[model samples]
Target: MTANPLDDPFYYLNNFQRVLAWLSQRYADVLSSEEQRFIEDFSALPRGSQGLLVRMVMRKGLRFRHGKLNYGEIGDIGSAVAPLLALGWVDEQAPLGLVELFEVLLKAEILSCLGHLIEQPKARKTEWLQALEGHFSQPQTFRDWCPQLEDRLYSLTVMPLCDRLRLLFFGNLYQDWSEFVLADLGIFTYETVEFSAESRGLRSRQDVDACLFLHDCQQRFEAGEALEEVVAQVNGLTLDNPWLERRRGKLLFQIGQHGERIGDFALALCIYRDCTYPGARLRMIRVLERIGEYALALELGETAAQAPQNAAEAQALFRIVPRLRRKLGGPPVPRSLAREVERLDLHLPRIDPTLSVEYHVQAHLHDDAAPVHYVENSLINSLFGLLCWPAIFAPLPGAFFHPFQRGPVDLLNEDFHERRAELFAACFAELDDGRYRQTILRRYAEKWGVQSPFVFWGALSGELLEQALDCLPPEHLRHWFLRLLLDIKANRAGMPDLIQFWPQRKAYRMIEVKGPGDRLQDNQLRWLEFCHEHQMPVAVCYVQWAEQGA
Candidate 1:
């Protein structure tokens, strides 16, 4: 019945405020007077204005489009920018000449789209400005612009490196440093790589406030800093806002991990006790066992065994607890615990039967046909990539231009939906005319490989795509496509294994393989139901033990 510390909003907000204050002092010499003033005046602004300012600074350009700014969540864009305008930081009525427009297009990375202008290099600045304005003013015309270049217009890369570093940190000042630390530990789930050598050493500010503070901590930790010193530093540092409050448990868990890495098992155990991280109990038990406290480990394991969050945790406890009990010369695991473990063991193996089924189906397929590559995750994502295109091409105003969709958590707003709706309708229209297939093929032909924070493009073979187009029923395609759009995150996984393709006949059939005792998962069942509804040619192939023996 213990209350969560993060339940109070101020828990993170207060910490973020403190970090900003620390940054102001820490980088006093490196930051300009204007930059320092901005930091000092940040907290004094209204919360909405504060957010808007952060958004503006994070954007690529010093000047944002007046038209796009009108639709953001921050009420009264003019009122929000009034303070910034008075500070002489922003130019509200900045003139957009031809040269400025050309630079903007180049920075936005959409210059390629204006090939005619590039070919006619002698085009006047006024002509360039007029062309740019004309392109962006019309929704239909602008929708054709390469979606990837949307955020190019908003980049601050033209700014001095130190200033860019300040903006990067300021935009993410409210984030939990522990989450970044955990990412370094490889425990945080991430879809893309954020930091690179090119990014790190670009600036000349030797004492630049570390843009990624947790990364800096990790480097120091690796250089043999004492566990207590690291802990003291972490305690002294404050960087979090409401968005990061939800990650407090992850932070605590990572701190415990830090202790464990330094061989401070006792310290790690103590930290785990206070950590609300998932699987903390198991982690604590492991630490106890490492310290030869077998009896204590068994006691903790038993409690964990009784109420695990999932089959995986239950299975871990089932395997580890009894072994510890036996090693400590204690009695066997209780009957209830043993049965529960056995049940989980039986079901857990069925959750992802792809590996098992891949081999079985591959062996059965013709040599000319490639067996199911088990890229259901990538195939659906590639299909829905267009949904994110408009956001990429002409990103919403303010801090909404996150190419990787990593920050500014409030991504979806009325404007976002409106744009998505337009894209969705246009996408479906293309689908009806069979242009969507061509687009997917063209995207593949262009070798638009997986770019982190953007769409994941699977290496879909031409043969497979061609066969799929020929064999997959239109009704089934529509059904699954609609379902995927409705819930991209949830629907992306658990697809059937083994798409056996016949190049000779231009045919393909999706096969969901199951071992003798395995059953379909909920997601798998959902896919099957949709296929059945559309009368798609899909089959469930059950491999019996006797058949395997043969």
Candidate 2:
């Protein structure tokens, strides 16, 4: 392996070739006819032409100006682009509207093109765009739009095709070619897990199309398209893939949240009724109450309370259900008393205005005997990740598909823990037998800088790890790890902001800090409640700046 992958001028091209080959070999059944042709044709092209095409595909936009495109490795831009234009992969006569034109041209060019219509010559590009929006309803070739500006624009007509390939490789559209560059630069590293027969994210052509459709729907929804229209189109498609189904649920959940934000309670209720996304029921109860349907809200809340989906929903119900009952004019239900946690009140001088409240408390509480680290959620999560590394990264069907994945695909899925129960049980057994400390430390050293969803390596120091291992007992670690497994998504967050460890006593205290006017959030309350129930040493620290509250 090369120390620096980019030392070879064709590094990016090499990566692209690897992806194409991987897909051709592993995903041959799923590849569309057009995709297969592109792969075959792309491979046969001269190295320069291949490099140039990869450069354009990796870039932000489809349109590229010949003068702006320069790569010494891919010498002679005009020569490189000839084969692409011939293949119709890159178009010279692609139409561009005023908005697209404005993005490419300089201020002077825009002024020259539409100076007659502009009331103010010195106005911003946005104002000029609005001034010309109605004038040019039709899109024209960049040359036709700006004939006076002597520059050639090449637009890649195969952007949609490239995007499909990218989606297949990354398993999603959000991650792109930048992942390759990051890995090459040694900024991010990923673990290699064995891929099984069913490891691929998109197993069929229909699955690929559905994933692309969802991507387009998300784009349209974010671009402020008509809500009902987008929702209708989104709801029209029925996906068989559970992963895709979860994505659809999440999109609908977001749409429902947006409706609530815009005070569309009826629409939110309609969405929540059918949406299976986690927390939709909670949102539904709130929406029902918002629209003055307290009885209905109570009905649903009570039903959910009987068997809440997760700790988050159960916590929300505990608060909302009683208030909802009172709203229905029923007998006043007593508020359930909160589990008391250790409290620390301080009015500390703010020496560094740049530092956060958690840091301020950490600095004040630090000593030679007791060292406080602003760990927040990183320490525990990192410890759990390190100790349970083998189980988490174990190769299972449908878990790992690509070389770049940070964790298993089913990490957030409901059955993630159940699928790997035996592996996790073995890992947990290490904690019971006092072998967890060695396992965690060994994994921490070996897997250092490797990507993990749970481990915050930047926040985890060797000293902190050693201190935590010495102080935190195996039983407490087991409790925390088990809670994380119960609901990985919900329980992973909302940990205390600071942890002070007493290595001499083999003791530690997690402290959740709250600044002035900052009350505990629902998640924080849930974590505090959990700690209280488990008899863990945790505290809630309230800080009032002396300047304000003295």
Q: What's the residue-level lDDT of 273 in candidate 2?
A: 97
Give the range where candidate 2 is weakest over 10 consecutive residues by summed lDDT: 1-10
TM-score of model 1 relative to the true fold?
0.39
Model 2 clashing residue pairs (backbone): none
Q: Write the per-residue lDDT of candidate 2 for residues 394-493, one digit (tens) a residue.
A: 9988888788899998999889999999999999999889999999889899999999999999998889999999999999999999999999998899
Off by over 4 Å in 1: 1-215, 236-255, 276-281, 295-299, 302-312, 325-455, 461-550
| Local accuracy of candidate 1 as per-residue lDDT tens digits, 1-550 | 8654445433333344554664554445555565666566767887656656555544456656534665345777767767766655554334444445455454324355565444344566555566657445432212234344443222222234334443444444343334433443444433332332222221223223433454455557668666666655644545443223324355557778878887989888876876655667778988999899998888888888887744346656767887897898878767552111101111122224555654645565537554455555555555555334433333333323122334223232213334456656676676678776777667556535433233454445676566666655555566666665544445657777666666557566677777667887767766775666666666777665432223
- Which candidate number would show the highest lDDT if scored against the true structure? 2
Question: By summed lDDT, which 10 consecutive residues of candidate 1 come out lowest?
Answer: 338-347
- Alpha-carbon RMSD of each model: 21.5, 2.3
